[model samples]
Target: MLNLLGLDAVAESVYRGILDRPQDVDDLCDRLKLTEKEIRDALDRLSEMALVRPSTEDPGQLHAVSPHVGMEILLARQQAELASQKQRLEASRAAAAQLILEYDDRRADAGSAEAGVRYLEGIDSIRDHLAVLREQVVRELLTFAPGGPQTQANMSASRPLNQQLLERGVQMRTVYLDSIRSCTDTMKYVHWLTEHGCQVRTVPSLPNRMIIYDRKAAIIAAHTENTAAGAMQLTSQGAVTTLHALFESVWQSAEPVVRQARPTPGALNRQQAEALRLLAQGLTDEAIANRLGVSPRTARRIASGLMDVLDADSRFQAGVHAVQRGYLPSTPL
Candidate 1:
């Protein structure tokens, strides 16, 4: 139909009316119940589209072109346009890639005094950015996960990524809070990493949570006080060097987390000890529950009992008291 070919309804009707033969505007107007001017306008549009053509015998009359011919021409033109657009996009992609390379070269020449810094505003953004950096890991990766053990979900997400990095021959060294070793989830992930040739160690505390990629770039929590707010990528020589140095200093003093989960002779049971230990590592009760394979309620009960024994008013206080009493080992056992 002419309408499907981009003609108005009036144009479509006028074209259809004279498909078998040519008709002038006045005849089309009478057949379509339209004004002569409307018929002329319709015919003009149809003519422009090649849907209708002026008859060779009578220039005043119009007839429809065979769809096989008209539509084939339209479709061929559309295909050409699409191919042209694709080529333009391909050219733009190449230009963008070149720009990125040039920018990187400029940054390298500038040295560590300047930085390629960016802030990832939300958790999803932070993770996505980190994922990109992880993929680009060439030789080495260093991560410092402060506070405590990772949640089951976090551990699960990291499993395949860590596995892939190792598969690519990327050397990885992760530093965790010593308390993470007490959690089942962290233990599992650490064992998996060690098995796959990743070096993992733990410190009692870290100043910030960060990941350094090949000493060329580093990602650190943006908020010094509230690291959960967002993350920042540091690509300046000075900043990256500072972070790398921090990681190295800590790496030297931190103890290697033993993959072997051993029973501790202390005031708490293994599950309760692990839960309390994670609490000291800066994990919430929810995280504690995830690691202990217990319900949140159960984890809280264990924490509450420990708090009562320590006579502590807050979770942090409970952690310190537990450590002081040897309920949670602060050093590698």
Candidate 2:
């Protein structure tokens, strides 16, 4: 039925009447109770779409074509259009791929030449390059992450890459915002990583999310602006070294996770104290969950409890309290 073709009710009726029996334009208009102009316009469109045909015997008579023939013609046109579209798509993809390759090669060449810095864009491209560097991590891995929307989102999406590094025995040391210590999902992921021998730590300071792999390659956010969503991967020895030094300076001041023990004496009841200790050390809620063998949400709740106890407004405040209480005497920032 013409209704099935998304035609209006009057148009469908006119089309069905004509298809059932060839109709003169006047009869089609009268039978369908439509104006002459409306019928004529519908018939013209149907004809153009190859859904209707003109009677050879009478110029004014019109007949609806077989649905099969209409479908065949429609399919043929669609196939042709799809083929053209595919060609264009392939051309575009090829051009984009070539541009990426050229950019990467040029970046490498520039690194060799000690030229100006290069920038990379998009999450997919960044992940792809990071996966390659992760494979090349032979000695050590260090990361600094400040909990924010973007960093958390990226970490969630980069699960496979993290698991891959763990499976390959890459030594990973990650520092995160003490605030993350309260996030349940982050804690579970941290537990997963630690179970596989990755060393994780926490610190109170807000260090931008950064990753240094094997002291030879480093990835850092280009700016503090949230508007930009890209990271810069530094491969040049000098740049990497500088980042490595910065990482180490922060790492040395970070609180190391004590994997072998639970909360120390009198720290259990004061969940805020424990939470403060963990945050000041830079453990995410996920890491805290794993460390405490608790659910991520529960770990976060405990952190919240700690916050309440300290009468502190933020994780940073709680961390400062822990330091003031001498929980972080050994690791001074």
Candidate 3:
């Protein structure tokens, strides 16, 4: 009960023990079954609080003061300290809000600050700022995550944030490599996202990794050799329009991951048809792997398998035969 007034367990126990009877340090150690250091530390804190005192007959013996007097004084001091901290915290909060408002006002007035482009360096910074952007999204969030499915840890990090965004009633549409549906970790995330009102689609290849928040601000990753180099944030009308148009084109041809992508004839399997289309586009094996969400070796094996199925000796021959088989249209699109 004394803990509510700032007394810790050891201090409270020692005070109660002294109230039972005045005792020397050695007696306290024996009765409380505590180390001498612990008993002495408790006595020192209680003495400072005026909750304990030395016996007049033997200065080494400890005695408890009246709780009605001593504990009430301790409680009053603690309450005053808490009130002071609360006032300081409120002042800091007000100062921060005012500072941010003035900074934004000044930024809006600066001509150079109107460039509408922000270059962010480092993957961690990019992710950190993305969280900031997510909070500002109101109407919709459109994202294209190219290359492959995200790792489990990364997905876990954003899982709650994504769910919270949906709960805010923000419309979300995401695009990924068609192969994400086969990965256990990413597929699980995708399932959860869709269940919570996120619309998801997939394609054999996406032009780049991009996110457009309400079509107002667009962020594009600049990655090389599967490593994130940095990112670009574009807010100009021209840039946003161009990126949105590109997304629309891809979104049109992309397959819906679930609740969509029904079969169409002319007739290789969906995986083989996607592989053939990518090959016909002259994409390298590694690029194909990124598009297919598979390893480079697996991508090469897929290409080889397609070649055999078409009875072709080379990729060009495979493309030609695949077209004749109606797996791909004459125009690559």
- lDDT-sorted candidate list, best first: 3, 1, 2
**TM-score winner between candidates 1 and 3:** 3
lDDT (Cα, tens digit) per residue for candidate 3, span 51-129 = 8999887787877987788766664444211111222333333443342233222222335248676666678888888
Number of the top-ranking candidate, with lDDT as the measure: 3
Residue range 1-333, candidate 2, lDDT tens digits: 333233556665666788788888888777878899988888776776677877887767787877677665543332111111222323333443343343343443556345434565666777687777777887788887664212566667667777777777777888765445556677667766677787776644333557787887777655433314666666667666766766665555445543212223333232344445556668899866654445589778988877765567998886676556554443533
TM-score of 1: 0.46
Determine the backbone clash count of candidate 3. Answer: 0
Collision count for each candidate, in order: 2, 15, 0
Off-target runs (Cα >4 Å) in candidate 1 are 1-114, 259-333
CA lDDT, every prediction? 0.66, 0.60, 0.72
TM-score of 2: 0.43
Residues 1-333, model 1: lDDT tens digits: 333234557876776788857887777777779998888788777666667777888887776887687665443322211111222333333443343333322322234235476666678888888889988889999987875777888888889998999999999999876557558777888878999999998654455568999999987776544566777677868667766766776676556765222222233433454456467667887766654445578678878877886789988788678667756556623
Stretches of candidate 2 exceeding 4 Å from the true structure: 1-113, 148-156, 258-333
Colliding pairs, model 3: none
